[model samples]
Target: MSDDGQDLAEAQRAHWQSAYGDHPGMYGRQPSAPAVHAAAVFRAAGVRDVLELGAGHGRDTLYFAREGFTVQATDFSATGLKQLRAGARQQGVAGRVTTVVHDVRAPLPLPDASVDAVFAHMLLCMALSTEEIHAAVGEVRRVLRSGGIFVYTVRHTGDAHYGAGIPHGDDIFEHGGFAVHFFGRAMVDALADGWRLDEVQPFEEGDLPRRLWRVTQTLPRERA
Candidate 1:
């Protein structure tokens, strides 16, 4: 990504920071369903080390750490990280959790093939464009070890309530006083070329239907 793109991402992060910085439990105290599901997958697969992108409030991070996984929880907001650190300390799992400030649209700071599992919840849906989503996916690919698992949830483009007749090519959605992007399966699969698709479960939250993709793949022979 260019410097201009980084600036836009930073701006978006700042917007979110301002919106939820004071409410530490804005995302929730417990992990999202996708994160809980991902934890089960990781435990079943015998994976121990986990990296979570956009780990708002460290809900999943705290859960995974308490379950004996070494977790690196990262977000772009300093306020979010401060809340996450406080949460970890309160849970007495601060040693098990490592927090970092990372913008997913940029290259990840971790060493190549370092993480055993990756989790992203409601992240892909926030990118304003397909190009940005692909860049974030590239960063996800960069930080995972071979045969690592990736479990994430995205707002499906097919939901009527959330879809709101938005054009197929349009990535942005304005609803419920929030503007975010929704992704279709095609767009997600396009960026997930090397990864083997394990599951694409369609479900609903309240009235909003969503899709969760669970995948496990080896790092391609080439580096990002």
Candidate 2:
């Protein structure tokens, strides 16, 4: 939204703002493969309520809606969320999708133990600091109902672009006017600290051969 925050997230926010401005619908009108795969997983798990972070352009948001999932989709970029809402309305799934302007670096604007599942794509691998990442994961755990699922993808350290640009921070590199924080096994492990790790698999995307880790986990049905 407003480019007024004094933090690393501000820089990231500005970068995406410019990108979305210059190239609205940059990724086009298609849900990612991970979204399709996640939908299948949700089906088997009987997940109905979902919260999606960084739902850029409503691609995955609309996908989940089409698959009969009720979703609360959030993104920091007004342009992106605006595009998302438009897409949702165009697909006649506006009633199933709720859009919110939110930055995941801060606390989630949701009640505790509310959502049945949380989905995010490439949101965790942005230029977030470790503390921000930890905070985001903590908030996810807090907002998830017992036995809630969390599914996300992050740029992996094995990616082709991992060490190609200016070193900004821990596991982060600035390349092509964008900053990315790449993940290792340990990083993903830490994020699954409070949840049971269900699956972790490697995948690649785009022509850059961007290596990624698709993660799935669940909070125990009965918390101690």
TM-score of each: 0.85, 0.95
Q: Could you give candidate 2's per-residue lDDT for residues 42-109 as a string of tens digits?
A: 88988998899999888899999999999999999999999999998999999899999998977899
Give the residue spans of candidate 2 off by over 4 A.
1-7
Give the top-scoring candidate (TM-score).
2
- Worst 10-residue lDDT window, candidate 2: 1-10
Q: lDDT for model 2, on a 0 to 1 scale?
A: 0.89
- Displacement of the residue 173 alpha carbon in candidate 1, Å: 1.8
State each model's C-alpha RMSD to the native.
Answer: 3.6, 2.6
Q: Over the stretch 1-224, how does candidate 1's per-residue lDDT look in tens digits?
A: 46654554566777779866656678778776777778888999889899988887788889998888999988888788888899999999998899998777667889978888888877777745678777777777777877777887777767553555433235666554445677667876786687877777776653344443444444444455
Q: CA lDDT of each candidate?
A: 0.74, 0.89
